[model samples]
Target: MIVLHNVQKKLGMRPVLRHIHMEVKKGECLSIVGPNGAGKTTLLKVCACIHQIDAGSMYWNGQDVYKQLTEYKRNLGWISHHHFLYENFTPVENLRFYSELYGVKNCEETIKRWLKIVDLYVFKDIPVRTFSKGMKQRLSLARALLHEPSILLLDEPFTGLDQDGVQLLFHLLQQEKEKQTAIMMVTHDFSHIEKISNKVIFLHKGEIAAESVQTEEKHIKEMYKTLVDER
Candidate 1:
């Protein structure tokens, strides 16, 4: 499980996240939603340790993440709007490189499995620069999941995906949830929030304005409009 207590962050002098508190247990999916510049991506980046927090603490399984940053990062997987692939490398080569970097055993088999899972097996030999945006996104997902990290952080993962790609991603997320991987996503895709996430947080102006658990009667969309749109 991952927990954040009164977490705060800033870019230069502008505060991006302020006094945020949240948690995602094993096997749970939490979705962060809000309008543009609501600090949604910043929150995810903070969780991924890409951006340092100015205050508060982050814990992974009861230990302070900063105390064991290297170890803690080993269990984390992140996917962002940028694909982050080596454009000159083929899909197989890219995965192979990441696999080796993560010290994944059976590198060949693992690379092959993820390629098939993301439906990129057919293009595994082609350089990533030759692929379309949707193809690159799929490869990026494969790269993030290659080592099967315990926690997954995604920022606008569904961007540039086609219907088939979206369905594939949904399927992959479901598989991850079933495996007890904690998932946190920042996205504006409201339509599928209820389907994939068990909890939702409405972030506005760097703070959590409202939150909803899956068991709640109010739909996520309704809460978004009430807390985010109204303000």
Candidate 2:
């Protein structure tokens, strides 16, 4: 389980997140939704330990993440706008590198399996620089899931995906959830939120304006509109 206790952050002199509190247990998916400048990505960065928080603390399964930052990162999987891939490396090489970095056993077979799962098996040997945006996104997914981390953090993961790719990602997320991986996603696509998320947070100006456990798509849309318009 991941827990954020009174989490706060600021970019320069402007405060971004304010006293944010949330938790996502094993097997639970939490979705963060808000208009631009709501600090959604910043929150994820805080959780990922990419940004130093100005205040508050975060924990993973009762352990202080910062105290064991290196060990904590081993259990974290992050997929963001940045693919974090080596442009010169082939898809196969990319996964192989990550597998080794994560100390994954049977790396050769694991790399091949993930390449096929993401539909990149045929292009496995091709350099990533030549791949399309959607293709890179697919490869990024494979990279994030290669080590099977306990927690997954995603930022606009479906941005470059087509219908088929979207479905593939949906299937992958479902599989992760079933394995009890804690999932936190930041996205503006309300259409699929209910299908993928069990809990929703409506963030407005860096604070959680509202939250709901009833994740019906229609209800979420309505709530989002009401909250945004009121602020």
Candidate 3:
């Protein structure tokens, strides 16, 4: 449902992403993996229509994303590497407020359901800033699902999680895939790629180095090792 055509981006004289042509099929889960400064985040922002491309274009379901950014964005959800919650507000407050903002129906029911899904129902009245990174991450997942978006963009989603938290996230991805939400995730390695992503694209020096379809070759960790060795 998302497409990028010969896309290029730069920050002043430094190029971040170049000639990035990619397509995310409806209901597919694709992961972008690379070393630091490999332009993973930059590429995602361009595809999400949150950053301007210096060259080429991006589209969502045949609609030019850059052209109708505001309208196109309503169907998209974002989870960044940084904390996305209000420090002073309780979890209950944040979820309730966002539900109203998104004009969600059965808002309270949805919020409660998501909170339970993320295992944050007990801490509903606690301030987010006081929670652990894993707790915050769980709440963030609930927030992303708040609007029932069709496309999801996640950046460094596992940054602050332990093994159990990571496993929980994997289950969440499976759930989203079942619901046919197109998910684009930026990950650090291949160890977790197989369980979480159906496709893996490696970004190198602002360009797409390679793409692997899960198909029968679900050895994500092995392939990722090969990619790293080849360079």
Q: Output the number of the lDDT-best candidate.
A: 2
List TM-score per model, in order. Answer: 0.96, 0.98, 0.92
Which of the numbered candidates is closest to the native, going by highest TM-score?
2
Whichever of 1 and 3 has more lDDT, that candidate is 1
Whole-model lDDT, model 3: 0.83
Off by over 4 Å in 3: 215-231
Q: Is 2 or 3 the stronger prediction by lDDT?
A: 2
Segments in model 2 whose C-alpha atoms lie over 4 Å from true places? none
Task: Residues 1-231, candidate 1: write the lDDT tens digits.
Answer: 999999999999999999999999999999998889999999988888989899999999999999989887888888877998999999999998899888899999999999998988999899999999999999999999989899999999998999999999999999999999999998877777867999888899999998888624357767877886578
Estimate the lDDT of model 2.
0.93
lDDT of 2 by residue, 132-226 (tens): 99999999999999998999999999988999999999999999999999999998888779789999998999999999998888999899999
